[model samples]
Target: MTRRSIGIVLNGVTGRMGYRQHLVRSLLAIREAGGLPTRDGTLWPEPVLVGRSEAKLAEIAARHGLTEWSTDLGAALARPDVSIYFDSQVTSGREKAIRQAIEAGKHIYTEKPLAETAVAATELAELAAAAGLKTGVVQDKLFLPGLRKLKRLIDGGFFGRILSVRGEFGYWVFEGDWQPAQRPSWNYRAADGGGIVMDMLPHWNYLLEELFGGVRSVQCTMATHIDTRVDEQGESYAATADDAAYAVFELAGGAVAQINSSWCVRVYRDELVEFQVDGTEGSAVAGLRHCRVQHRSMTPKPVWNPDLPNSVPFRTQWAEVPDNDEFDNGFKAQWEAFLRHVAEDGPYHWDFASGARGVRLAELALQSAREGRRLEVPRLEVPR
Candidate 1:
């Protein structure tokens, strides 16, 4: 059996998502598991941490017991051993770094909304295509156990001729005055390329297209419920970005998807985000970890009797979807898939173009909200 090592230059890993998910949970976990198994041999992932703060990068490297850490991106890219570049940086800084990585002739994997704007994202896609580089954008939700089960039902024709999809996603983020904000302070600043719309609409766009039909049009409204919030330093600043977004999307198959994404709403559901998809033959509600379904044959009949006390067990009517296979963390799953794609030239499609489409959705959603009207979601063409 042959053995090989794959060096990955990981940037922006000092952030929470980058450190927890990409580092500890995914790449490090893969490394600790005796590398990723392949037909010929094993592919070991070696992470070369890169960030603005050398101190923070050194600390992380020390914690992981790994040594190749650098503060200069150009120096990291110069290493011939590093064949891949992974970025989990802020939205505003992603495009330039990705462009540089592409120029350096490295395969790339990154967080979503590939760039702050659609134009820059398209350019990156074009550049990568021209350079013959393998690229992937994070679409972690698609790999969730619940979504996988939902996908199984869709494939099995359980939801024959799907009709509509309704999703509710949110939890109240404490203002820094009372409690330190769970999210980064930059997330609420528009100047820093922040907002729930930019952060979430990309997720919704991919989820809609990959599972159901592609989005044909969109209508949306956004709001900033909290005008001011304290930062990590206990200094208050204006929350200029929208904290909530209510959107209605029309799919190509004539199905409608209504999604409400917010950071200010209280949670009453079983999960942080839940999607309910209804069709002619059945309906299913899926969260991050669980899925519940109701067949058309077993659906209950509830008449309009507002005067009398309701006795029907609406929630009990649906059956829980069993997990036939043990589920790994969604981020880890995607990381393995991407690794396989890079190692063996496996099939991968969540590319820069797909991410650009997501950015386009957010841009149009904002425009739709401003105009107070529905807008068409046009086909995106990346001119290479």
Candidate 2:
């Protein structure tokens, strides 16, 4: 049996997502679950931690039992041991690291926003194409059990001729005032590639575009709801980035979708992320854990009476989605899939092009919000 030991250079290893998702879930979890299986047997993929700080890197390395740790990013890139350059860096530092990785002839995988703008994203895709190396980005939301069920319903025509999609995504993330911020301070600064539109639009873009339809045009309004936020240092800084964004999209299939994203709003629903789909034959609503469907035959009957304080007739008609062992822990599922893509010739669609498309969509959405006009999505002509 031939076993391939794939070396992965993990950039931004000290960050939250980098440490938790990429390192712990993808690397360490893969090990705990048994090595990635191939047709021949299985493969072992090792991770080398990359960061700018020695202390932080050392701390993470110690925690993770990683023998390889480095503050020098370039040396990690030049090493022959590293076959894959996994980037979980801040949005601002993403482009440079990815470009260098591609130039070094390594396959690449990264967190969202391939670049801050569509133009830069396009360039990166072109370069990766020229190099003939495999590239992928984390589109973890699509792999969620709830969304997977949603996709099944749509494909099965449960929502005959889908008409629209509505999504509410977020929770009240503390502003690092009394408690330390869960996210970095840079995420709320516009100059640092921070903003709700830039950070989250990518997730919506891929999921909506892939599940609902290709987004043709977008109309959006954004605002920095919190003007001042205390940083990790307990010093107040001007929050120039957007804390909230509301976007309405027109899809290629003639379906219209509205998405509301915010860092300030407390979740008033069953889940932190919820999507509601209304179609000609039926309507379905899904949260991260559960899915509910209401069909045409089971549609609710209502008589309007404003005198009553609050009365809705939509409860009895809906049926709850059944639990399945296959669908659980969306992030972990994506990790398993990525490992399969790495070790075997399994289907891998989370490529750089898809990642770039997400960035482009976010870029256009931001542009629409800024100019107070709808922006058309540009068509990409992939090189043959």
Candidate 3:
């Protein structure tokens, strides 16, 4: 069996999502599994962690027992041996670095909300296409166990003639006054390219389009519920970004979707994220890890009585979907697929064009909110 090592320059991996999800759980986990298997043999990802702080990068390398670490991104990008460049940087900082990487002829993978605006995201996609460099953006939710099960049900015609989708997502992010902030301070600053709409709408865009149909129109309302919040340094700052967003989307097949995302809302659901789909023949609710289904045959019949308490056990009516297959970390699954796409020309559907489309949806939704009216979402065309 032949073995090949693929050198990857990972930028901004010292951050929270970069460190925990992409580096520790995804890349390191893949390395621990003896790398990814390919037709040629095994393709091992040799990652060189790159960040702004030398101390932080060095500490992470030591903690992970990794040999390669660098504080200089330009030098890392200039290296001939590195074939791939991965970025998980702050939204405002991603464009320049990604552009340079594409110029350096490196295949690129990046976190979502590719840019602050759809135009910039589309420009990046066009640049990568012109350069003939492979590019991808993170769409991790599609690979979730529950979503996979939901997909199976959809494919099997379990939810015949799907009608509408409702998604509830969020958890309370403590303000830094009493407890340390759960998220970075920059997430509350509009100038820093932070907002719940920009952060989450991209995920919903792809999810709605992929699972149901293309989004044709959107109506939205965004709010900054908390105007003042203490920062990481214990100093109070004006929160300029939207903390919450309520959006309604009309899909191509006449399906409607309502998704609520907030950073200030308290959790009451079984999971941090949950999506309920209602259809003609059945219904299904999928959380991050669990999925429940209720077919027309097994649905409960209940009679409403205003004067008396309901006797029906509403929660017990739906049947839990069995976990018949092993589920891996969603981030790691995408990473492996991307590596294979880079190494052996494997099939990969989520490309830069797809990422641009996600950004376009967010842009349109924001416009809809600002105008206080439903707006049409035009399709984003990418050159082949």
Candidate 4:
């Protein structure tokens, strides 16, 4: 067995995403799992911590008992010890770091929205491919248990011909009026690549494509529902980005998808996020962790009475979706897949090309919203 010792340079390891999702849950957890086993029955890569703050990096390193650390990304990239560069930085700052990492000839894995614009993301993807380095972007929602169940149902033809998809995704991210804000302040600034449409459309693009087909066109409207929010410093800042967006997608397979993402909405259901898929033969509704299905043949028909309040068709039609343990936390599952791709030489599906496509979708949605016109999505030869 050939033991491939992988050295990973972790950028943006000090952020909230870096701490819980990347460090403790992914890299550290893999280390605890005795590393990812390769086809030859040996562990492939080991993680090393890198960040901007030496103190915070040192703190995390101490917590995880990791010794390899660096504050200089350039130095880390140049090190022979490092074989992979992972970035979880703010959306605005991801491009430069990833570009440099690719030039360094290391396999790259990072979070979404490859760049602020579609062209830039496309360029980045080209660069990584030209460099012959393996690359992947985080597309965690597809691995979610609820979404997985929905995918299974779709694959098995449970819904028959798909008609439409409706999604509601949001929760109040509290302002720092009493406590510190949970998200980055730049997330509300347009200059910093922040907006509900830019932040969320990518997820829907992949989801819609996976469930139905590629998006042929989109119509969207975006708005800044909250004008001002206080940060941890007790200073009020004017919000310059859209906090809410309503988008409609026309899929190539004739399926329509409507997505509403907001920062001001309150959760009043099974989860903060939910979706309803209506098809020719049946319909289904899925929350963050659960879903229910109803077939037309199984649906009880009833008369519609405006005066009579209650309806019978709704009461007896829907059935609780059976629980399956194949799914886990979306992020964790993607992380595991990533490790497998690195270790076992497994085919990596969510590569840089896929990431670029997602960014393209977001850019197109933003353009459509601003111009008040529908935009066509260009199909790319993204790797499967």
Candidate 5:
């Protein structure tokens, strides 16, 4: 067994996602699983943790029994062993770091919202392409168990002809004055590239495009429900970014999707986020871990009446999709996929250009909100 070791410079390990998902769950898990399988042998990822805080980085490294980590990104990138650069940093810092990675000739993988805007994201894609580097963006939702099952049904013609989709995603992020905020304070600051639109529309774009069709237009409205929140330092600050966004998207072939995302709404649903897709032959509601379906034949018919008491076992009508297969962590799956792509030239469709498109969708949705009208989405291209 020829096991090859390649270093991945993981920037932003001090952050929430980079630490938990990318570093621990994905890379370390792969190491525990005997590395990523390859035709030749296995490709092992050696992580070079990079972050601003030396103390925090050191702690993470020590906790995981890892030794190679540094506060300096340049030095990390300069290492000959490092071939892949992964970013999960603040939105503002993403473009510059990615550009530097590209210049360093590293294969790149990064968290979504590839850049603040479509232009920057497209530019990064172009730069990566010019350097002939393999690149991937984290499209984690498509790897989720529920979404995977949903995709399966769609592919198997269970839905017949997909018609429309409705999505609800949010939870009441506690105002830090009463309780410590679950999310960081920067999430509510626009200048720092924080907002529901920038954070979530990218997710919606990829999900819709991959499952149903490409989004063709959008109508959106956004709001800042809580203007003030206490920061981690116990200082109060105004929330300049929109915490809530309601948007309706027009997808290719005239499919419609309406999605609401917020950090200020109370949760009264089955999951933190849920998507309901209705088609000609059937309908399905999918959450993070579960999917339930109601075919046309099994769908209940309710008679509308203002004066009569309605007693329909609506919730019990849909059948729960069984766990036909064991699901791996989504982050780990994507990481393994990216590593395989880099090492063996395997197929990976989610490139930097796709990330750029996700950013473009967010941009247009924000514009649509500002204009108070629906706007057409133009096809974005990254120059070869």
Candidate 6:
């Protein structure tokens, strides 16, 4: 069998998500598994770590037993061997590098919120399409086991005319006074393209569209509950970005979706992120890895008593959905699909155009919050 090496220039490897999820979990894991096997050959991923810091890139390369590491992004993009250019960089820093990579005739793949604005994101998509390059964006949540099960249920007529969806996401990020903040300090700064809406609305946009329907309009309110927070350097700075976002979306098929994303709220649910879907026949609540359901036949009818303590155990009424098949890591699953797309020219639905739509949702939601009115989400047109 022929063995082919597909070189990938991976930028933003120094950041947390870039290092842990994209590099270590996905790419390195693929490399460790002897790469992806095709009909004619094995497509081995040869990754060149690209970042701004020479020392960090070198350290990561050495730690992973990798040979190629570079601090010069332009030089890395110019390499003929590197056919795929992957970016998981900061939101504000993505557009320029992605434009450069597209100009260099490389297929593009990157994390979402493709750019800080919808205009920039659409421009990148147009550039890639004009260059005739295969491009993909990260929609990893669609591959989660719980979401997979939810999709199965929907397909099986379990919901029976789905009605609405509710999503609760986020955890309290430490203020960095006593404990260091879990998220990067840049996440709370508006100047750095940071906000809960920008960070999460992309996920919700694609998710709602994939599950229910396209978002038609949105009404939202955002808040910066914690106005000041300590940074990585132990210096306090004003938090200009919204720490919390409450959004209500009207879907195309008359389905309503309400999503609350916040970094200041404490967790009281089964997972860090959970989505509840209600329908005419049944309801299901899905966490990151688990799903629970309550059918109409099994649902309880409890009398409301204002004078007496409630005796109904509403949480215990739901039954857990059994795992019928083995599940892979969501990020890893997408990575494998992207690799196959690169190797065999396979069909990938989550392209730059899809990402541009997500950016449109985020932009609309932010505008709605600022204007105090419902804003319509117009469809993005990119050359296919």
**Inter-residue clash pairs, candidate 1:** none
The global C-alpha lDDT for each of the candidates, from Candidate 1 onward, is: 0.94, 0.85, 0.92, 0.82, 0.94, 0.92
The parts of candidate 6 lying over 4 Å away from their true place are none
- Model 3 misplacement above 4 A: none
Question: What's each prediction's TM-score?
Answer: 0.99, 0.96, 0.99, 0.94, 0.99, 0.98
lDDT of 4 by residue, 1-384 (tens): 556677888888899888889888877776677776667765645667777789999998888778888888898899997878899888889999998998899888998877888888888888888877788888888887788888889999998899999999998877767767768788888888888887888788778877789899989998898899896578898889998999999998888989899988888767788999999899988877788898988876677788887746474467888875666567767776776676656777788888888888888888898899998887876433
The digit string of per-residue lDDT tens for model 5 on 1-384 reads 999998999999999899999999999999999999899998998999999989998999999999999988989999999999999999999999999999999999999989998999999999999999999999999999999999999999998888899999999999899799999999999999999999999999999999999999999999999999999999999999999999999999878999999999999999998999999999999999999999999988899998988899899999999879999999999998999999999989888999999999999989999989999999887853
Over 4 Å off in model 4, which ranges?
A: 1-4, 311-316, 381-384
RMSD of each: 0.9, 1.6, 0.9, 2.0, 0.8, 1.0
Q: For model 6, what is the error of residue 90's alpha carbon versus the real structure, in angstroms, after optimal superposition?
A: 0.7
Candidate 1: tens digits of C-alpha lDDT, residues 4-105: 899999999999999999999999998888889986699999999999998999999998899999989999998999999999999899999999999899
Residue 341 local lDDT, model 2: 74
Per-residue lDDT over 1-384 for candidate 2, one digit per residue giving the tens place of the 0 to 100 score: 666788889999888998887788767877776776778776677888998899998888888777898988789989998888988888899999999998899888889888988888878988998988777888888877778888889888899999999999988878878878777899999999899998899899899888988889999999988888999889999999999999999998899999999999987898999999999999989988778999899886777778885566566668987766576456666665776776565787878788888888888888899899998887765431
Which lDDT value does model 6 have at 248?
99
The true-structure Cα RMSD of candidate 2 reads 1.6
- Candidate 3 lDDT over residue span 1-384, tens digit each: 777899999998999999999999998998899989999999988899999999999999999899898988889998888999999999999989998898899999999888888889999999999998888899999999999999989998998899999999999998889998899989999999899988999999889989999999999999999999999889999999999999999998999999999999999999999999999999999999999999999888888789998888899999999989999999999999999999989989788888888888888888888989999898789863
Stretches off by above 4 angstroms in model 1 are none
Alpha carbon deviation, residue 39, candidate 5 (Å): 0.8
**Positional deviation of 250 in candidate 1, in angstroms?**
0.4
lDDT of 2: 0.85
In candidate 6, what are the lDDT values of residues 88-199, reduced to their tens digit?
9999899999999998999999998999889899999998999999999999999999999998899898998889999999999999989999999999999999999999
Residue pairs with clashing backbones, model 3: none
Q: Clash pairs of candidate 4?
A: none
